[model samples]
Target: YAKTSRTELLHFTVGGKDAGWMDKRAFTATLDKATYSKMSRGAKIGDAAVSSKHGLYTKPNNTAEDGEKIGLGSLYANQNVQIIQSAKLSTGVT
Candidate 1:
């Protein structure tokens, strides 16, 4: 396995597209729906917090309404390790 350091810079990708730069030590975790909702509502997980006007949901086979693109939450990843710069959204197609 390749070893990574906290200072190492790496490209973050989603579905083969470049998202942004992130520290090698940075990563994300899946939280329960309740925790996710809380974070979206300005709740903190430890010292990290997030706030958004919309709720996270999945509409399977759902098309975008009113030309609204699907959203990827800024806090979808763990806030503690996020060091992203010039972050970009992914189409999530591979």
Candidate 2:
């Protein structure tokens, strides 16, 4: 896994299609029917949570982005938010 951030777009290797944005962080696109079957509970995308029983990227986090408002929150913490400002990504995590 690339350990993609919630906002990073996922590209499919088998379908040649951009799986789409990680809406609320995607553990998996649950691509093919077979792929969906392979996952179990406890999987997650970003700050979003996965399905209760079916962990294979079943449910989406459903957290919407706060548009033009003042609040107590971080940008990168949201799905699909750019990390260019929050942290640096190099060849390694450490």
Candidate 3:
């Protein structure tokens, strides 16, 4: 069986001040030998695939009235924000 897992940690700053860090983890289901072999045979160097699910939201602040924001407290005065991401692939098969 083949299983894949990945983790991403990011540190961010705003206006030269430390904002916070975002940590994310992703996992893929284990593949049996036959499925893994088929996938491996079809894939080639430099080939790529992507899978993702994400959202952007405005965090509420103390000034916000009821039902004004999506999640918990606001971000330094109600700034709408989303995470920016990049990906790199590494292979261990030889």
Candidate 4:
């Protein structure tokens, strides 16, 4: 399996009527054959703590950009504000 840091905006309908939107992370979207096999055998996958269960994804290190802000922390603050940047626009993860 390949690893990537990407997110996608998904729009879909359930039961052909209900519509919804979500931010889908690429890393946990699908499972590879080998990892599936291991899971089928009752083996834990992905990152694990010493006293806890393992995660599903083989390499779940996915991250999303929440944008960068360069301004006053409080809205009431009387300070010069700088420009604020938004997160990158993404169609899908490669």
lDDT of each: 0.39, 0.31, 0.31, 0.34
Instruction: List TM-scores for all candidates, in order.
Output: 0.21, 0.15, 0.19, 0.21
Q: Judged by TM-score relative to the true structure, which candidate is superior, 3 or 4?
A: 4
Candidate 2 local lDDT, 21-41, one digit each (tens) = 443454533221111123233
Q: What are the per-residue Cα lDDT tens digits for candidate 1 across 27-93?
A: 5533222211112234322322343433333431122222333554444534444322221223332
How many Å off is the CA of 57 in candidate 4? 22
Give lDDT tens digits, candidate 4, residues 1-94.
Answer: 2223665666667789757666655224433222111212222222223312322221322322332333322332333434232222233322
Report the poorest 10 consecutive residues by lDDT, candidate 1.
31-40
Residue 54 deviation, candidate 1, in Å? Answer: 51
Worst 10 residues of 3 by lDDT: 47-56
Candidate No. with top lDDT: 1
| TM-score (C-alpha, index-matched) for candidate 3 | 0.19
Pairs clashing within candidate 2: 7-80, 40-55, 41-55
Model 2 residue 76 lDDT score: 23
| Candidate 4 runs further than 4 Å off | 1-7, 26-28, 31-94
lDDT of 4 at 32: 21
The residue-by-residue lDDT of candidate 3 on 24-58, one tens digit each, is 23323232221122121222222122111212124
